[model samples]
Target: MNAILRGVRVIDPLGRLDAPGQDVWIDGGKILAIYHHIDAAGVPVVDLTPPDGVDPCVLCPGFIDLHVHLRQPGDDEAETLETGARAAAAGGFTHMVAMANTTPPIDTPERVAEARLAASNLPVSILQVAALTRGLDGEELVDIRKCVESGAVALGDDGRNSVSPRQLAIALAETAHLSRAVFVHPEDEEMIAQANGTQGSVTRSPIRPVETETRAVNLAVRALSHARSGHLHLQHLSSEGSVASLRRARHQGLAVSAEVTPHHLSMWLPVAEEPDPQALRKVNPPLRGELDRVALVQALREGLIEAVATDHAPHRAAEKSLAYDDAAPGMIGLETALATCITIGGMGGEWLATLVERLTVGPHRILGPASGVPEPRLRIGESATCTLFDPNAEWTVGETPLHSRSRNTPLIGARLRGTVLLTLAGGRVIHQDPARVPIVSEQVTSV
Candidate 1:
């Protein structure tokens, strides 16, 4: 399987170079050669000739999602490993970390092994986050070593906050000894009771104050202090104050990193109308105020937010239609993430490259196994994991066209700039523009 992606603009965040009119050759799922010029007679090539009169599209490393819910073995109605991987590949993501909140939670090493087996055939890499507690109950700690041995990338109780500080400390201590990171949801139960939406009078729902997140983070940080350089990752940080707390912790030499979601950066409370419970916009660590949104965007530009994750939680429409309090929190995000980064974040080519690195290399460093690393100008002998994007292209998101099993995206009907033209994983085009030519199914294979 030798093919040349010629005449494409290559953006390598690691190399910090954006060179246009280059050729990339991929063979056996690894890049064979990349250069500005290649003789046609020397080797087989496929002209990825740019569209007439249009500049070549950007070719960058595939994205890595730090947080996503691929409800497998339980709630397949919402999403499964296979479907979620397909959606991720189409969205230009080559790897994703699956959360630990599914039914029969990924608490044991056996369960983690099960997930890996289930996802073995997917085109997108699926990394499992083992539960921080047995059954994610926050009472009993799971076997950290066994879970890690079973293929869990990290440990977390994503959907629920660890209720017992003592238990959390023990878990952190054990994970630290094992050289594994712990991801905390960072929500104090008492504060979370009143804090559901942005804190302000504009929204009817009670605001989940900044204190809720900061307080929980403080606890986690304190717990980590007892351990041996335990890496603590704060998930879905939504407040300016939360970011400030993490910043100070890092300045003080704490092993802390954080991620922010697109919705938190893109939307604010106090809409003309209150968000419908069924809108899928209702999410945990609910959307914050405009000021927070602005601060988060600034943090991204300033490199305070280490990664941008979709927190791609999905639920059936019927499930989301419940009352505001009863409806589940989360929305489908894999597909809309890149578009939102371009459209709402007001980021262009260079920043987009950085974001892709953050999604790929940054998370990979934290989780290890080292999948994402900067490449040298798309040279030969490189891994064949790449994303082709049309930055200037525009498209409207609709429920009917989304690949997620759930149609729970708030961006539906929203006009978005930028579209993924093709995604190649292991020298195979898992997704391609159907309008251009019907991609043979034989060319597609699971990751």
Candidate 2:
């Protein structure tokens, strides 16, 4: 349905528009025109103008998450593609990359097609990340060309980066012509095993030490130097050395881009020191200390780290209720990602434009400039995909019900600002929070 967003502040970083009091007209799944005023007699009208018209709600291109775990085709109890898509829309993401570490990993062309079928008609665009290896076993690369043909957006060995550097280089060289990237979860298996081996007992400190990630990053970067053409997209980088290695790689002109998770930026590892297990925070490539988080923020500010991706892994409550050592390593993230970044990581309105760009354009760049996904812009003929948010809106984390099937987030009781009010994909209002948004009217009136 066509809807005219009346008196909304448009934040279009690519178009270089930070204009207030604009009327954005959407029809036929595209932005028809953006004017100073529009009479909304033919369609519905969403009045975003605050009563006083000061510090009003903002409109930007629909958010995009480059990395997410939907757990479809394998674990529906954790999250289905439909539920994950709704959760993404509720979080203001119109598009997200679904990680392929499922029951049967998305490694073959047939599996990729199956995932596409599962994601059919979802609220969010499900761009499947095909596993680098046949089963994410770190050996035997998947048919990159075939998988892409079957609708795979990118390639990765999610949660498994201990693949032999030789094999990774070979796979990269083979798929170089495809122009699709291999997103790596940089973690050394030997280091983790060693960290646990040293502590024979079930209880262990630094299960996955800092060195595990840094060493893997170092190896991946070094190996990337030999790859033919394709870029190496690193996922969920948390350690200080990992950031430094990425920085050095960029300076050296290696085709590499990396993303940092919200949990890594805000929360630290409580499992190591706490007398009681903090199973909720237990994640793969485990969270580090304040020093690591400080460096991550510094790197992000310096433009060394280009994107912030919520490695939105969803696990069942029963699974999360187990002992720290036995409990699952991930929790739901899509619903609370923006607030977590804003409140916990201190990324507020001043950085809104940059934050929007990372979620929209930066992730798109990893797929390639010529990738078919439309650039998020506020121009006539552009797809009318937008996300409306109230930066100052306050709400408790868990109190606001998430759209996801699982409620495994750690930010249950934390109060947060920056709430998503509306999300439109292809001009369709896929998700709208009725509580926070103003009433839509048949007649439009300027504030």
Q: Highest lDDT among the candidates is held by which one? A: 2
Across 1-447, the per-residue lDDT of candidate 2 in tens digits comes to 477878878888888888878888777667887888888677777777777735667788888888898888788998888788888988989889898889888889999998888786776788888898887877688888899888888889887765788888887776677778888998887777777776322222337878888998988887788775668888898888898899899999889999888788777233113322367777877877888898987777666777888999888888777778777777678877787777676466577667777777777777775346778776688666888887778887667577788887666667777788878787667777666544432211110
lDDT of each: 0.76, 0.77
Q: Lowest summed-lDDT stretch of 10 residues in model 1?
A: 197-206
Cα lDDT of model 1 by residue, 1-447, tens digit: 455667878877666667889887666668766689776565555565677876567788788888999888789999988789888987888888999989989999999999888888887878889999987767888888998888888999998885477777777777776777888998776566555543322122334577887898888887777664678888998888888888888888988888888788787222213445544677878877888888887787777777889899988888788776566778889988888887775455567667766666676666754222233234457567878777767787773478888887767777777788778776677776655323323465644
Candidate 2 Cα misplacement greater than 4 A, ranges: 27-29, 39-45, 50-54, 198-206, 268-277, 369-371, 436-447
Task: Please state the error at residue 62 of candidate 2 in Å.
Answer: 1.1
TM-score of 2: 0.90
What count of clashes does model 1 give?
Answer: 8
Q: Give the TM-score of candidate 1.
A: 0.88
Where in model 1 is the C-alpha error above 4 Å? 42-56, 194-207, 268-278, 370-379, 436-442
